[model samples]
Structure formats: structure tokens, C-alpha cells
Target: MTLKVERLGHSTRLQEVSFAAQPGELVGILGANGAGKSTLLQLLCGVLEPDAGQLTYQQRDLTQISAYERRQLLGYLPQTPVAEGGIRVDHFLQAGLVNLHLSCPGKELNRVVETLQIHALLERTLDKLSGGEQRRVHIARALLGDHNWLLCDEPTTSLDLYYQLQVMAVLRAQADRGKLVTLALHDLGLAARYCDRLVLIDKGRLLAEGAPAAVLTDANLAQAYKIKARWLCTDEGVTLLPSLLS
Candidate 1:
């Protein structure tokens, strides 16, 4: 499956921005603060409608899909996922599947729960968990439905170094399994290491889109982020180090 955004715009927050994500690809949306990264994700997930463009999934216009039908194919984890303080972690996760009247195999749910390391927190209420724990719980909830496309906004926020890596690994594994995963991220190094494609935006416009190495050039970073950076490729992987403020 593929998601195509043609000249999508959202009021003053985003201009005419277009991009696409295909199955089996991990697309990272990278930009500075207020650079339309979150806006783009919101538009893609149908949280906000574009004022002046079209969004298509597998050649069908997204607007033509019923809200309930759309939700079945797309899973979204907003930057600040709201969880009722009263709901337990397990209940919250199960609600994701239940709301759609979808049945995820018990083993599939168990796999996501175990991958996120949230097995112990299942009984705890959302109000009782730490920020990172809650983030993991919400992430596990998003992964429950096996949707064709997953759009996550700053999912690594509040996560520590270890959990952040673990979360990225899980997302990468999802992409490897042929799911389209798109996320808004501020960490260039993490995006470089895990994402198959990078979409760089600035001032409400798309600046670059391609392989990480090509799209994350010094010129592009300087233009989009206003920073001097160096790219290092090692046996392990790619690393983008910001040298100095531009």
C-alpha cells in the first residue's frame, strides 16, 4: 500500500507539501520546531483535513473512505496521546482493538506487549505510570491492530536512551514486515540510523526527500535546521553530528 499526499496544506501551519510512503519503508519526517512536521502527520492520519490538496491511499482518495473504514487501515499515535487517568494499561491497549470491532489474535497482542516490555504495567492505571511507561503503553496500543500504515508523532519523547532504541527497533521491525511506518522526530542521529527515507521540511514546505544520506546533507541541514553538521558512515551505521549552530 502507498499513501500519496498531493500539495497538501493546512491553514497557515503548512503550505503545499507533497510526499508519499510505500509499504516496507520507514519514512522519517525531520524538521525544526514548528516546521510543519506534526501538521503533516496530522493531515496524513486524517486528524486534520487539508484546505487545498488531496490525500490518496492505494490510489483511492482518502476523503472517499468512511471514517470508520479509514481507521481500520491507519493507526496513529499523536505526540501527546490522551489516556484517561482511570484506565488501566491493558484496558487501554485492548480498547484500540475493541473500538474498531477488530480481533487481533492473542499471540499478536502478546508479541506487541512483550516487545514494548509493558507486560508488568498491564494492571497499572495510566495515572500511576511514568511518562516513558505511558508512552510505551500508548505505542503498544497503536501497534495492536496491524494496520497498513502507522503514523507516530515524536513517539520517542519521554523515553530514555534504552527505551528509545528499543522503540526504534520495534518500529524498524514493523517496516521490515512490510508495514508503512512514518514518524515525526527531532533526533537526526536516530532517524539516520533507522529510517529508510527522510523527508525534510522547513517553513511549511518540503525541502528534500530521498535516502537518508542524500536528503540529510550539510546544505540541507543548514537550510532547514540552520546548523553545521557532519555525517559519519561507519561499519555499524550512519551518524549525524551537529557541530555548531549556524
Candidate 2:
């Protein structure tokens, strides 16, 4: 399956952005603050309607799908996920499946909870957890339904270095399993290392889209982020070293 956006715009927040992501492709949406990355994700997940343009899933207009059905097909993790204070982590995770009308299989929940290393925190209330821990709980919830498309906004935010890598690895595994995973990321190095493709946005416009090397050019970085940076490729992966403001 492929998700295609055609000239999608949301007021002045976003403008004429277009792209297509196929199953098994990990597409990273890269942009500076206020560059409309969040707006684009919202449009893709049906949270916000576009002022102009259309979105299609496998050649059918996305609007043709009912919102309830759309929810079944897409899994969204917003930047600030809502975690009700009084609920325990496991209860919260199970509730997500209930809302989707999916069976809350014990094995499925255990798999995600273990993958996210939240097994111990399962019995703890969300209010008792740290920001990073709470984030992981929400992530496990997002992964519960095994939806076709996973749209995440800063999935690694508040995570330590180890957890950051773990979250990226989990997302990578999802894409490898033929799920379309699109993430809004600030870390260029992580984007270069893990993403199959990159989409660069600047001032509500699409500046570039291609492989990491092509989209993360010195010229494009200067134009979009107004910075001078150096790129290094190692046996492990690519590393971006920003020197100074342009």
C-alpha cells in the first residue's frame, strides 16, 4: 500500500506539500521549528482537513474512508500524547485496543511492553511516571493495534540515548515488516542513519525529498536551517556536524 499526498495545504500553516510513501518505507519528515511538520502529519492522519489538495491510500481518496475505518488503518503518536493521570500504564494500553474494537491479546500487549522496556512500569499510574516513561507507555499503545501506517511526532523526545536508539529500532522493525512508518524528527543524524527517505520542509514548503545524502546537502541545510554543517560517512552511518549559524 502507498500513501500519497497531492498539493496538501492547511491554511498558511502548510502549502502545497506533496509526497508518496510506500509500505516498508521509513520516511523521515525533517524541518526546523514551525516548519509545518506537525501540520503535515495531522493531515495525513485525518486529524486536520486540507484547505486544498487530496490524499489517497492505494489509489482511493482517503476522504472516501470513514473516520472510524481510518483510525483502524492508521496509528498516530502525537508530540504530546495524552496520558490520563489516574490510569495505570497497562490499563491505558489495553484501553487503546478496546477503543479500536480489537481484541486485547495478552501476547500482543506483552510484546510491545517488553519491546519498550515498560514491563516493570505496567502497574504504575501514569502520574507516577517520568516524562520519558510516559512517552514509552503511549508508544506501546500506538503499537498495540498493528496498524498499517504509523505516524509519529518526535517519538524519541525525552528519551535517553539508549531508549532513543531502542525506539528507532522498533520503528525500523515495523517498516521492515511492511508497515509505512513516517516520523517527524529533529535529529538529522538519526534521520540519516535510520530513515529510508527524507522529506525536508522549510517555511511551510517542501524544500527537498530523496535519499538522506541528497536531501541533507550543505546547500539545503543552509537554505532550510540557516546553518553551516559538515557531513561525515562512517562504516556505521552518516554523521552531521553543525559548525556555526549561517
Best by lDDT: 2
For every model shown, what is its TM-score relative to the native structure? 0.95, 0.96
* Residue lDDT tens for model 1, 1-246: 678888989895898888888999999999999999999998887778889899998988887777788778888899988758878887877777765645546766787799899889999999999999999998988887788789999999999999999999999999999999999999999999999999999999999998998988888988998899877888877677787673
Query: How much is 50 displaced in model 2, in angstroms?
Result: 0.6
| Model 1 Cα shift for residue 59 (angstroms) | 0.9
lDDT of each: 0.88, 0.89
lDDT of 2 at 77: 94
- Stretches off by above 4 angstroms in model 1 are 101-105
lDDT per residue (tens digit) for residues 1-246 in model 2: 778888989995899999888999999999999999999988888888889999998888876787888778889999987659789888888787765755557877888888888889989999999988888888888888788889999999999889999999999999999999999999999999999999999999999998998999888998888888887888988778987673
Q: Candidate 2: where is the Cα deviation over 4 Å?
A: 101-104
